[model samples]
Target: MTTSLVDAESVLAIEIGSIHTRALLFDVVDGQYRFIGAGRAPTTIHAPFFDISEGIHLAISHLQEITSRILLEESRLILPGKADGSGVDQVVLTYTAGQPLRVVVMGLLEDVSVESARRLAASAHTIITEAIGLNDRRPPEAQIDALLRARPDLIILSGGTDQGASRSIAKNVDLLTFALQIIPREKRPEVIYAGNHALVTPVKDVLSTYTQVHVAPNLRPEIDVENLSPAQDILADAEFHIRSRQIGGLQSYRSILAVEPLSAPFAFARMIRFLSRINNPGKGVIGVDLGAGNLIIASAFQGNSAVSVLPMGTGPGMAQALRTIPISEISRWLPIHIPESVVEDYLWHKTLHPTLLPVTTETAAVEQAAIRQVLWNGLNQHRTRYPNTPLLAEPILAAGMPLTQWSPQTSLMLLVDGLQPFGITTFVQDAHGLTAALGIISTNNAILPVQVIESNAFVNLGTVIVPLSNARYGTSILKVKVEYEAGNQISLEVRQGSVTALPIQTGQTARVHLQPLRPITIDPIGKDTTRSFKVIGGVCGVIVDARGRPLSLPTDAARRRDMLKKWAAGFGA
Candidate 1:
């Protein structure tokens, strides 16, 4: 057998999200994947093809332009007067579809299986089109009609334990059959049964008669736990196939040594999960990908054992911020006061023209607020979709276009603190929003990315210490000891109802430990006297408690403004 020689040169991977398309060249320097020059451009989805090839071309062209400029500036440093050398070795293009793969959940009970199904889909970043179950009490025809109208890409059918509850499973299978009969033959959806194993063959036979049918092990094998791997993989594969068939110009992508274009993001996400788990076990990790048309929120919890994706994006946020919310809300968050009508006009223009640059400072502030609002809303929706998971020292990982222009305060409020009902221990941002690109590259070439993530690819923004005594709301629960290296120690008791802020500037480490003051009764949503936690410094930096409990929007406008201002000031935002 003859073996082909591989070149040592770098290969460039380009990722096109719903909003922005980016290109990054990667080369192994000192056996590490170092980022060479990069380029970016707007994604193209309005065109007839929605193929992603055209967007890739625009991104590559931008990269070429920027590379040319960089080479021109650095030419004197190198001999032989070379401005451009080899250009890009190879181009790998990956994209996320603007349209989410609508998901339908069929299960036994609304609480047991339906809720778990919602969490699985949310973690996968897929959309739930319809959630139907035995308790739902909707007629077979109603469920079928909803399925056909939604034209979901895949159906996640779950019910019963391994040998428990057959009526719900049988009923759900009948509903699947009804749905397949009504949907067009060519467009019949894919079905995955993660339910009772005894019914798997029945499900396959019923759905295979008219649509694509797949089966994974029961998601709720026991009443207590959820096994999502098999189902998630099946759903991810179906999504790839569906997008590949629909989005044109994918044939060019199939020629790559490995991976189809549509499947690259999933592949990348899986790789990140693998690495994150290996490094930080049982940590809740979240990644925010902000695109033009849609924003994808990917989250992983329990040592990367779980992941979910959300499709709400800045495009919709910009539109809603400009129209749905008042100009006064926008003004309150602005750095400097401006006319409400002027802000309205600016936001109106932005809503109509989604891609305009913020030319003035006032406009820039408005854009920042719009970004914050979008993230806040998106995170709220995320929490609601998947609730009641204890967050333990989780790091919020965010990558987006807006992050490239992220201010410290905006980053803190929107990223570090936004959507964190529990509390975020650290906030890490990908400067180029190219995690997907890195993710895709890591599949075949895993070493580079493995090193990158291990070696400071993520910046730690101090730690957040939360004191918990399992106490009821309004209880004085615990005491915290914070030891600073600068020869100072502070002891504080956590009080319920009021959020205590312990200031910790960036680059200062505090060692903090907690001691429960009393055995406190726990309240689900309300604050008790024992609701207090303490702060400490660590190897990373001083700990702060920015946990704004009693999740509520500022009701009094003036009071809300003052509170926000105080929060901003306290956090050094």
Candidate 2:
């Protein structure tokens, strides 16, 4: 006997950000999941409403008006759908508005278990205020003082293998317990033990009296292996629990969710992992979200994934982001001449008023410059964390207001100049900022993500071909021929140190053949060989960049402006 299975016919996913609350509707159409519609409203976590539910209801009301569907009944979400097709079958929520968890990591070895714990913290939206290791040369009194001053929300105690050392682990636990005793009971940090399993009971006994105690699998069970999923999961659960308790209306919001709300960064990371596993073999997927106060960079290869959350962004965190890179680094991307002081002032003003959009071309240019720096910082952090991961060669998904608010040309240029990937790569933007929403729904039901992604949830920005070479300027880098339907053909020569774009509408496909000149590499396999491959068109069409590896930009004032103008014209920017 065979059993029949049915998928949820209708679903509503909501994402509450620091400034905006967005809702997306998906329904099964013709036996496939499809994105129905989306609506957004200013987040009401603060000010007049002071209730997140208000913003969610308003956003859903907008969706109801758009689709003529009744999602809310008496200020409550209608669940399991209605016989009249007026409700949804399920609802999921994700958020990124609350303060990041303040965490302190304690480990035995600085490079061993300590490093693994640090990587786990990096995977979530957290601020590592202090990390204590056994190698510290400071006196125990001073160390305890620093730990007490940090005032962490949680403590991650990890050291020792499954059956390794117990004496040293007890010593570290003793120190942590003493520190917790000094603090008030209501203010003590929760403890998560991810150390030797054999000592979990003893460790809990020592710390449980001071605060809540949770246990996870050892982060470094063996010296040769680093198991982070267990720790990552526990950390995310703890963060949600703490956030729901601290935020004013989130506790009530939690009661309505079918499942616990997930952090935006965690959900986004999972979505990237799922996409990387399903699509693209032997490569990885990179998803970047540049929020007002945070930047999330998630990469997934096969089934392994890593997320790096940088606390600096365009709004509340802009001042810190500015200190990381020099003013000249951002000014180089601006086509027009702007003084460093003026650029600095613009960033300061933006930090004060993040919702303000660029009103003029000059301001727009400055905004894009800041975006480039943010992307650079995100990519740099990814590289530092996962040095051996493959290049961002697969489809790249970009989110956040900066990319969505700007024209496709300008957004694409900013990405290209910042990442500078070689070979063939496809770039796409999260058209409706549904990455986190889709990710949460996908976790509950696997078929939903495939359905929504197939329904054109993302806007394809086209494929780019960048040849890696260091040939002299003005030299012929490669000869390209593009053949489409009806025997139409376009043949052109791209020069070294130049950026060129070819027009191709979205949903169009072309057969591209490349013949590289001597000492020039078109494909990643061989530098001096000819290559042929099929390419897809997008809103920004096809861009062929032969601007040698390291992507040199002219330093002289006059020449730099001329070069910028030429590149901008090529991309219709």
Highest-TM-score candidate = 2
lDDT (Cα, tens digit) per residue for candidate 2, span 151-222: 998888898999998898898898897899899987888888999999999888878888989899999888
Candidate 1 off by > 4 Å:
1-11, 48-50, 68-93, 124-126, 136-139, 165-168, 260-283, 293-295, 301-304, 317-352, 359-366, 384-390, 420-424, 454-556, 569-573
Model 2 RMSD to the real structure? Answer: 2.4
lDDT of 1 by residue, 246-349 (tens): 66665556664244454434644565465456545645566666655445555555544444454444454455445455656556565555677887777667
In candidate 2, list every pair of residues with a backbone clash: none
TM-score of 2: 0.95
Give the runs in model 2 whose Cα sits over 4 Å from its true position: 1-8, 47-50, 523-530
RMSD of each: 7.1, 2.4
Highest lDDT model number:
2
Evaluate residue 408 in candidate 2 and report its C-alpha lDDT on the 0 to 100 scale.
88
TM-score of 1: 0.74
